[model samples]
Target chain A: MAKHVLRVVAVVYVLFLLVLPVALIVWRTFGDGLAPFAEALTSPSALHAFTVTLTVAGWAVLANTVFGVGAALLLVRHEFPGKRLLGAFIDLPMAVSPVVVGLALILVYGRFSPLGGLLESWGIQVIFSTPGMVLATVFVSLPLVVRAVVPVLEELGDEQEQAAHTLGASRLQSFVRITLPGIRWALGYGVVLCLARSLGEYGAVAVVSGRLVDQTQTLTLFVEERFQNFDQPAAFAAATALALIAVVTLLFTKLLRPKDRSDGN
Target chain B: MAIEVRDVNKSFGTTPVLHDVSLDVAAGSLTALLGPSGGGKSTLLRVIAGLERPDTGTVRISGVDATRLSPQRRNVGFVFQHYAAFKHLTVFRNVAFGLEIRKRPKDEIRKRVMELLELVHLEKLADRYPSQLSGGQRQRMALARALAVEPQVLLLDEPFGALDAQVRKELRTWLRRLHDEVHVTTVFVTHDQEEAIEVADTIVVLAGGEVVQAGSPGEVYDNPANPFVMRFLGPVTEIGGSLVRPHDIEISPDPVEGGSPAVVSRVVRLGFEVRVEVEIGGHEAWVQVTREQADRLGLGPGDTVHLRPAPGARSLVLAL
Candidate 1:
C-alpha cells in the first residue's frame, strides 16, 4: 500500500508538471476545426512575424558562431590577465533576465545616446527596429553557444595541432584541416542552441521590437498578441509551429551528440 | 643533416627546465636522449623540433640557422608518446596528410601512403581509424605518419612508453630495423636504459636538465660518466667508497694477488648467474659468478670469498 501511494504521488507530479501542460496546449490548438490553423499559416502578419523571427535568429546565430569559436579558442589555448573574469562575464547573460537585456540595448541605442545619434545622423535607425531585435537576441542568447563549446575546446589539447605543425602544415592549414574538424560537432550543437534560444526569446525582444505589427514582430510576439486579442486558435496554431521547429532541432541535436567510442571509428 | 644546439635555455615560469644545454647530433645516425623522468629530455626534443623555443641561444639544423623558424618551416617529424594520430582520419589518410598538405598529386599520395602502410605492415588495416587499432598497431601507424613526410630530422618523444612490455620489445627491434633502412638523423627520447642501448647509435644520458654523459652503449656500460649514470644504467653496489656493478666483480676462493678478502653476505640466483654479495671494508658489494665458479669456490650465503676490481673499468668519471 505504501509503494502504491509513492508511485501515485510521483506520477501525479509528472502529470501536473509535464503531461497536463502539453495536453492543454495541443487540445487548444486543435479545437478550431483546422481552419484557423490554415488561416494562421497563410496570413500576411503571421508570415511577416515568421520572417522577422528567422532573420533575427539566423543573424544572431551567425554572429555568435564566429565570436563564440574565437572566444573558445582564446580561452582554451592562450592565457592572459583576467581571463577567468572574461569567462565569467560571458556567463553573465545567462543569469540576467531577458527584459533587462532589452533595456540595456535601449539605453545604448536610444536616440539620445552618442552611438545612437551618430547612427541617426547617418539616417540609420537602430532602436525599435529589426536591428534592435537582433541586438536583443544576441544579448540574451550569447552565453548559450559559448557555454556549450568552451569545455570541449579546453579538453582538446594542442598536441594534434602541434603534430600537424611538425609535419610541415602551415598555421592556417592546421587550423582548417585539423582544429576545425575536431571542434565541429561542439560548434554545431552550440549553433543549434543559439538558434533555439533566440527563436523562443520574448521579454528582451518584446521591449526592443516595439510591437510593430508586420514590421519587427516575431513569432513569439505574434502568439502573445493573438492570445491577448482573444484569438486563441490563431495563437495556438502559431505556438504549434514553434513547437514543431523545436522538436526537429532537438532530434537533430540528438543525432549530432558525440557517438560512443566503439562505433565512432 | 647535423643538428647543433648551442647554449639553449628554457624555463616554465620560474622553474628552469633546460639549462644552457648543448649537444651535437651527426646526420644519418639514430641517437637516444636517455634520462630519468623530469630530466628535460622531452623538452630538448621539442626545442630541436621547433615545437618549443628556447629562452636563449640557437638551434641549427643541417648547418642552417633555424632558431627562429616555426616547426612547420623546420621540416621535422615528431611521434608523440600517445601516438597523437588524427583520430578522425583513416590510417591511410593520416599517412597521406603531410603529403596532402604539400599539395601532392592524388595518385602520388595514394601510392606513397600505401608504401608507408606496407612499411609498417599495416596495409591491410589502412582503412581503419586509429581508435579501431590495437595499441601496438596505433604506434606503428604513428610511425608511418611521421615517416610519410620524409622529414629531414625525426624526433620521437617516448614513442614506445605507452605500449605493453611484449609489444614494446617487438616494436623496439622493428624500430631498429626501420631506422637502419631510413638512415635519417633521428633522436628518440627514452628513460629506459635497455631500450636506448638496444636501439641508439649514441646514447646521451641526461640528468637534472643537463647532459651527464654521451657515448656508445657498451662504452657507457663499461665506464659510466659518474655515479648517477652507473646507478641509472645498471644494478650498483657500493664498496670501499666506490660503486661497482655486480657483473663486473670477480670472485675467487683462494686468496689472490691484488684482491680483497670478504665474507659472503648472500647469494641470489639471477637465472643467468648467481649474484654474490660480499662485505668488504665495511661496505657491501655484489659480484656475479657462473654456476661453475660458485661450485668451484664452494660459496654460499655465510662464507668467505676474495674480490678484485676488474681492469679497464671506470671508462668515464663524472663530476660528483
Candidate 2:
C-alpha cells in the first residue's frame, strides 16, 4: 500500500513537472500532420543551426574527451602537489553556471581585452565566433567525461600495467593494449554523455554566439529565436528534436554503462 | 639467470623499507624471501626485478648491473599476489600478450600460449575472461602469462597469498613441480614459513628491513643466527634468557645433571604430541614429548620438574 502510494506520487510528480510539458510540445509538433514539422526542420536557417550545433559539439567533445582521459589518469594514477585543487577545478564547470562561463570567456577574449586585441590583430577572431561558441560548449560539458572515467580508473589500480611492463611492453603499448581496453566501456559512456551535454548546451552558446541567423546560431538558440518570432511550429519542432536526441542519448548511456559493478567487469 | 644484490638500500619517503640488504640467488635455483608483513621482502623482490630502484648499491642480473634499468628492459616476469589478470581479455590473449608485443609470428605465439595454458592446466578455460575463472585458476593463468615472456628471472610476490589454505597448498606443490621442469631462476616472496620451507631451496628470512638469516631451509631452521630468526622460523620459548624451539627441550620430574630447576605449569595435549609448559626463574618455556612419555611422567600443574636440552638436539643454549 505504501509502495503503491509512493509509485503514484512519483508518477503524478513526473506527469506534472516533466511528462505533461514534453507531451504538450510533442503534440503541438505533430498537430499539423507532420508537414510543418518536416518543413521547419529543413529550412535553410534551421539546417544551418543543425550544422553549427553538430560542429561545436564535435569539437567540444573531442577536446574534452582527450583532456578528460588525461586528467582522470593523472588524478587517479599519480600523486603531486595541488592535486586536489586540480580535481576541484575540473568539476568547476559543473558547479558554475554556463552563462558565467560564457561571460568569463568574453571578458578574456572580447576584442577589447589585451589578449583579445592581440589575437584580433593576428587576424583571429575568438569572441562572437565559432571558436568562442565551441569554448563555451566545452566548458559547460567539461566534467562529464572526467567524472565518468575517474571512478573506473580508480577501481583499476596499476597492478596490471606494472605486470605489462614486466612482460616487456613499453608504456605506450601497455596503455593501448591493456589500460585503454580496460577502461573502454567507461570511456565510451563518458564520451556519449559529453556529446549529449554539448549538443544541448544553450545559455553559454547564446551569449558567445551573438545569435546571428545562419552564422553562429545553434539548434538551441534557433528554437528561442523562432519562438520569439511567432514561429511556434518551427520552435516546437526543434524542441521536440532536442528531446528526441536526449532520449536517444539516455538509451545509449544505459546500454554502454554497466548497470552496476557486479560480475567484476 | 643468477641474481646478485650487493649492499642495496631502499626507503619509501623517509620510512626505510629495506636497509642495506644483500643476497644471492643461484642460477636456476628457487629462492624464497620469507618474512612477516612490512618486512621489505616484496620491496626487495621489486628491486631485483627492476620494478624499484635501490637508493644505494647494485643489483646484477646475469652479471649485468640492473639497478638503473627500466622494468620493461629487465626481462623479469612479475606475478602479483592478486593474480593481476587482464580482465577484458580472454586467457589465450592474456598468455599471448608478451609474444605479441615481441612480434613473434602468429603461429609461434599460438603454439607457445597453448603450450603454457596446457602446462598450467587452463587450456579448457582459455577463451573465458579472467573474471570468470576461480582465484586459483586466475593465478595459474597469471603464472602462464608470466612464463609466456620467457623472462630471464621469474618473480612472484606472494603468488598464493590471496587464496585459501587448500588452494595455497596445491599451488605450492604445483609451483615446485613447475620450477623443477622449467629450471628457471625464480624468486618468490611469501610470509608463510611452511611454504618457504617446503618449496624454496633457499630461504632468506627478513625482519625490520634486514636479512635476519639466509641459508638452506634446514640450516636456517636447525641453527638460526638470532632470536628473531629462530622465532620467525618456528615457535620459540624464552628460557634462561635464550630462545629455543618447543621440541628442543625436555622436561624431567627430578633434577638431573646440567638440568635447570622448573615447575610444571600446564600439560597441553596437542593431537598425538604432548606439550609441557614449565616455569624456570619466572620465565615460561615449552617442552615437547611423546604421548607415552608424557603419560609415564604423569606431570601436572604445580608439579616440580627440571628442564634440559633433548638428547642430540642442538638447542640455542646461550642461556636456555
Candidate 3:
C-alpha cells in the first residue's frame, strides 16, 4: 500500500511540474474557436514577427554552432595558460540571467559605445534592431552548445587520432576522418540545443529589440504584446506555434541522433 | 632492418623512467625485453616506435635517424597489450588500414590484407568486426594488422598477456614460427621469463630503468648477472647453509658439516622425482630426489635427514 502511494505521488509530482502546464496551455489555445486561430496566424504583424524571429534565430544558431564547437574543441584538445579560466568563462552566460545578457549586449553595442557608433556611421544600426536581437540570443544561448559538447569531446581519447597519424594520415586528414566521426553525434546534439534555446529566447532579445510592429519585433515579443493588449486568442495562437516548432525540432533530433548503444544493438 | 637505440633517456616530469638505455636489435632477430613491470621495457619500445621522444639519444633504423621522425614515418609496427583494434572496422579493413592510409592501390591492399589474414589463419572472418572475434582471434588480427604494413621493425607489448595459458603457449610457438617466416626484426616486451626464453633468440633483462643483463636465453638462465636477475628469472629456494637447487641434495646416510640436521616435514611426489621438505634453522627447505634415489632409500615424510649441498650444483649469488 505504501509503495503504491509512493508511485502515485511520484506521478502526481511529474504531472504537477510538466503535464499540468502543457495541458493548461493546450486548453487556453483551443478554448475559443478555429476562426481566432486562423485569423491570428494570417495577420501581417504575425507574419512579420515570425520572419524576423526566424532570421534572428537562424543567424544566432549558426554563429553559436561555430563558436561553441571551436570553444569546445579548444578546451578539450589543447592546454594553454589559463585554460580552466577560459573554460569557466564559456559557461558564464549560461549561469547569468537572460536579462543580464541583454544588458551586456546593450552596454557593448549601444549608440554611445565605440563599435556601435562606428556601425551607426555605416548605417548598420545594431542596438534596438534585428542584429541586436540576434546578438542577444546568441549571447544568452552561447554555452548551451559548448556545455553539451565539451564533455563528450574530452572523454574521447587521443588514441584514435594517434592511430590515424601512425596509419599515415596527416593531421587534418586524421581530424576529418577519425576525430570528426567520433564527435559528430555530440555536435548534432549540441546544435539541436543551440537552435532550440535561440528560438525560444525572450528576455535578452526583448530588451534589445525595439518592439516596433512589423519591424524589429520577434514572434515572442508579438505574443507578449498581444497578451498585454487583451488579444488573448492571438497570444495563444503565437504560443501554440512556438510550442509546435519546439516539439517538431525535438522530435527530429530524437529520430536522427544515433541509436543509443546502451540498448545492446 | 636493424634497430639501434643509443643512450636513450626518458623522464616523466623529473622522475627518470629510462636512463641511458641502449640496445641493438639485429636484422631478422627476435629480441625479448624481459623485465618486471615498470622496468621501462614498454617505454623503450615506445621510444623506438617514435610514440615517445627520448630526452637525449638516438634511435636509428637501418641507418635512418628516427629521433626527429613521427611514428608514421618511422615504418615501425606496434602491437599494443590490449590489441587496440579499431572497434568499428571489419577484420579485413583493420588489416588494410595501414596500406589504405598509405594510399596504396586497392588491388594491392586487398591482396596484402588477404595474405596477412591467411598468415594468421583468419581469412574466413574477414568481414567480422573486432567485437565479434574471440580474444585470441583479436590478438592474431592485431598481429596481422601490424604485419600488413610490411614494417621495418615490429614491436609487441605483452601480446599474449591477456590470453589464457593454453592460448598464450600456442601463440608464443606460433609467433616463433611467424618470426622465422616474416624475417623481420622483432622486439617482444614481457616480464614473463618463460615466454622470453621460449620465444626470443636474445633476452635482455631490465631492472630499475637499466639493462641488468643481455644474453641468449640459456646463458641468462644458467649464469644470471646478479642476485636480482637470479631471483627474478627462476624459483629460488634458500637452505640453511647456502642457496641450492632442489636437485642438489641427495638422499644418503652421511652427515656432513657446513651441512645441518633437518627434520623431514613433507614428501611430495612429482612423478619423475620426490620433493622432500625439511625444517632446518626454523625454516623449510625443499630437496628433490629422483624416483630411483627415493625408492633406494625408502624415504618419506617425518624422517630426520642430514642435509649436504652438492659441490657441483652449488653456485653463489652476490646479494644486492
Which predicted model would earn the best TM-score?
2
lDDT of 2 by residue, B178-249 (tens): 999999899999999989999999999999999888999999999888767787888888666667687778
RMSD of 3: 3.4
Poorest 10 consecutive residues by lDDT, candidate 1 chain B: B311-320
TM-score of each: 0.95, 0.97, 0.87
Error of 3 at B41 (Å): 1.5
Q: What is the lDDT of residue B226 in candidate 2?
A: 75
| Deviation from native of the Cα of residue B278 in model 3, angstroms | 3.6
Clash count per candidate? 2, 0, 0
Error of 3 at B115 (Å): 2.0
Where is model 2 more than 4 Å wrong at Cα?
A: A1-5, A259-265, B317-320
Docking class of 1: medium
Residue B315's lDDT in candidate 3: 50
| Tens-digit per-residue lDDT, A1-265, candidate 1 | 9999999999999999978887788788877667778887679989989999999999999988888988888888999999999899888888999989888888899889999889989987888898888889988888877877787767667888998998889889988988887777888888898898889999999998899889988999999998999978878889888988988888877877754223235
What is the lDDT, from 0 to 100, of the residue B304 in candidate 2?
A: 94
True lDDT of residue A9, candidate 2: 100
- For every candidate, what share of the true interface contacts is present? 0.75, 0.77, 0.25
Determine which window of 10 residues in candidate 2 chain B has minimal summed lDDT.
Answer: B311-320
Task: Indicate whether candidate 1 or candidate 3 has the larger lDDT.
Answer: 1
